[model samples]
Target: MDIVSHLNDRLLFAVPKKGRLYQQCVDLLKGADIKFNRSNRLDIALCTNLPIALVFLPAADIPRFVGEGRVSLGITGQDQVAEAGISVDEVCNLGFGSCKLQVEVPDQGQFTDPRQLIGKSIVTSFTNLATDYFRKLEAEETNGVGADEQTQSSKPLKTTIKYVGGSVEASCALGIADAVVDLVESGETMRAAGLKAIATIFETSAVLIASQHPTHKDLLELIVNRIKGVIAAGKYVLCNYNCPRSKLDSVLKITPGRRAPTISPLEEDDWVAVSSMVEKKRIAEVMDQLRNKGAEDILVFSISNCRV
Candidate 1:
């Protein structure tokens, strides 16, 4: 199809080639009905069903590409966006791959607060966020000092931030750093490495981001809406049931949907059919509640994709 030659005409969608979010991002695109094929040796794939090109790059590099307008859209971690310090518009939160960027010290260490690590050496991949956090703490400490004392001090001690591409947790044991700022999902890795989180710098999840100025705004919006629909489908389920007309008000209370429940007539007089979308996690309890409220023939359906 001469994909490379026609790339300029298609919207570029940067995706994580491999990492924690890679598989999930692939699943999201599939859910959105984006069809594509790649040789795997190639980093780019052209969607057969849409005028889009998926550029698989490192998750951390996505924000830079999208922010610089080199790509029209991307799915990457919120922490990556913050660390990149780029000016991309966050289209929507994908609500998966949730984690926290945190400050962690050795478990046996006396440091229990991020403030205690000021002026100490910290190793991290996220050099910018870590440096900014400690600098803010340093500024606060300086603000508390008397004006005369501040004048006498040579300068506020600067926190030493070292950039490590990986294995930040080993820095403390190796005597190279006092602590580390890293992403923690389950804390198992930190615990195994004899570390404990003192403070969370920020909680983050996968986010859909767009260039500040996209070449194809309409196409970008269409893909964004489709991805949002997939996210909504993952979090919710469609619930349908029949109930007495007199009990409709009560059933509505049990399943009060995102907006409102859909009601339909039934063959039996004084009876009605109801349909609503309920949170997937609470579907069990919702069904039980409806059954107790004189609802009958209850059913639940999984939503593959939805607009809302």
Candidate 2:
């Protein structure tokens, strides 16, 4: 165990403090019924029943923390992790904060492929990713000189990077840059700025990152299990209904669930109260199907946490 980690048995966890990803992390925890009861102004969160110290940091800094082992765990986007070249292993894909990192250009431009960019300059905030992409695209199957000679070879593919504060979509229209490498969520901003994506560089989502360093194995396992439970619970809903013996088979077929449905006798001898979990978004559809098969007193409730 590292001296630092050994000194602090409490796991250090980092989360994004602002932006879309931060809200998602909070919503996921709230949906799991995990309360954060720290001072309103404080950036640190303490899990009610866990020994973990949560620090809210800038989203872009999360990878650095996880990679350096300053924090034992982190919740941030996959793009940031890759960009930072972090080696932390992913523990979970939270399934939110979905977006695409792409190379986009002005709608009027006819440049569709990398070959056309051989002599052109590309502007982007993701300097590393952009440089890597263009380097490979400019490179060819043949040897450096042979390929460069055989290719257009008119001018070297020059990539100049410029970091704008925000709103990269407008860069193309304003003539501040040729093309932009940025996150495209709904393409609203892109369309508004008369920009169209020419190439998708990467698809990103929120991921849970865990440190590779040694630590309290038991505590780490407990924390992991609890977090997983919270995630599973958010994806499922508890549903219960009464059905006659004749319709039990039909009801079971509709609510087969992740494992098996719990069936118990009701006060009425001919009926049974069967309970199971249905996917959260599909609860209504499943309930309707069960109702059509003679299910009565149908009830749906959110599951707070689950462990398997």
Candidate 3:
């Protein structure tokens, strides 16, 4: 598991050490056929099959490392990238670990809109994003677009934003802030704490970020393409079937591949073979339609990975 002998010339890839995103990132790498041994208590690991060395770090810290060129690439939440306020090329959306950064207030409070809590105190782990949100509100107020213009015209709302490490939802109940901004995977946690979301600051999911100063452009592009291939492969399946020549056109419409369905001549001159890629989720419905349209010998098989 040392892998150090092959690590010196590899591109550094940072991923979350422990969190909701850690295992998902590992799965994505494996799906792309990047092999590595993740030994316990190891901060760094080498991808034996690729020119990449993975650095395990906090998800929140991934953005900074990539931005500073300390790591050539990383995977982290879009919200974290915004919070870090760094410049990095977003390669692609991984489409997992979806969540929302929201503004929540106590259930019994009189708050009905974001404008209602203008001058009130808010607490959150995302202090910078919270402050930036307030600044935008102030600018909107100056342009006469904010509600309660007359009251807010004289001076911008001096909203107080406090930073907390964790349990931001408890801040309101403990009188630390009038409202709290935090990540919400489900409304259950907020409901349990007697709080409700008043506004969603931003939506987020895991995304691949690449350094602007990449030293290994070719390797980076290869990994990115492999990941894209894995993601596309998961969403689709291969559908192969035979259809009478007269019904070939109709059946082809039912299972069109990325470009077009593959058609081949059959031993029976009046029949033809058709093969196409269909979405896995809609395979049942697609099969039914093809059968009704005179398709025969239909078969659907899973694809481990594909380029298109």
Candidate 4:
């Protein structure tokens, strides 16, 4: 059987084959307990424990596959989905691979604003987004003008947006383009290339997306919940402690969990034990606050996986 025939009964999940999000996606799958062994030089992987097949493709292509229903699910950057202009359901934010799509100019150039380079050439992989941004900018400039004047002012944007698969930053240095629109994570790479950001287009992060109509809707929900569990596990920890009855109200305020903290009476008079989930980043501060509130035996435990 060919690949399509093999996947006929399995839900197709598109993942980035190789890019900034590839490894993080793989780790997420592992954390969700989706067992699979990808063969050497093959783009497809069959899950051993589920009726799901992983289709390895470029991050830019995953959104198209999911949006078209060719793949039931996908993990990709929100910017890719926007650039594709595809209709799909955003399942949840995975909270990694965060970056911003920015309009940048040469650091030492006279152009300091995106509007300054409006009529200049821009090179970027996100051609559609770049074109739309510049078009909107031009429209904004003609906002208060008369209809005829606006029409005259909005002649085809003098700004030319050319698509370059890579090396977008080098376009300015090579004199082929006056500015570039690209993804910036730390701003280090752009600085190294002598480019500075003038305007931010949008912020994006890795997102789990699903087809508008999934063939295996039930299975897709199961997988989505599992992925959410993995994300929650990474973000929070279980906090346990004992507090006096008089301090219960004050202590609960410090560790207000997803819901209410679980409270159980202790054998000793006027004492209660509390268990709650706290953000991993704020655990130390929460512990200190609990201690100050007359709580004792405060302990933090890592969560491997959970439904909430």
Q: Note each model's CA RMSD in angstroms.
A: 3.2, 5.3, 3.6, 2.4
Which pairs of residues have clashing backbones in candidate 1? none
lDDT of 2 by residue, 198-298 (tens): 88888999998888873556766766777778877878999999989989988899999889989999899898999998988898889889888899999
- Model 3: ten consecutive residues of lowest lDDT: 148-157
| Model 2: CA > 4 A from native | 1-9, 27-50, 112-115, 135-165, 267-270
lDDT of 3: 0.88
Q: Which residue pairs in candidate 3 have backbone atoms (N, alpha carbon, C) closer than 3 angstroms, thus clashing?
A: none
lDDT per model vs. reference:
0.90, 0.77, 0.88, 0.91
- Candidate 3 residue-wise lDDT, 1-308, digit = tens: 44777667899999999888999898999998889877889888877788789999999999999999658899999999999999999998888889999999998989978777778899999988998777667657556555464554456447888899888889999998989999999788899999999899999999999999986889988888999888788888999999999998788888878899889999998999998999899999999999999999999999999875
lDDT: the better of candidates 1 and 4: 4
On lDDT, the stronger of 1 and 3 is 1
| Evaluation by lDDT, superior candidate among 3 and 4 | 4
| TM-score of every candidate | 0.92, 0.78, 0.87, 0.94
Count backbone overlaps in model 1.
Answer: 0
Task: Give the lDDT of residue 280 in candidate 1.
Answer: 98
Per-residue lDDT of candidate 1, residues 92-112 (tens digit): 999998999999999998999
lDDT value, candidate 4, whole model:
0.91
How many residue pairs in model 2 have overlapping backbones? Answer: 0
Q: Of the candidates numbered 2 and 4, which has the greater TM-score value? A: 4
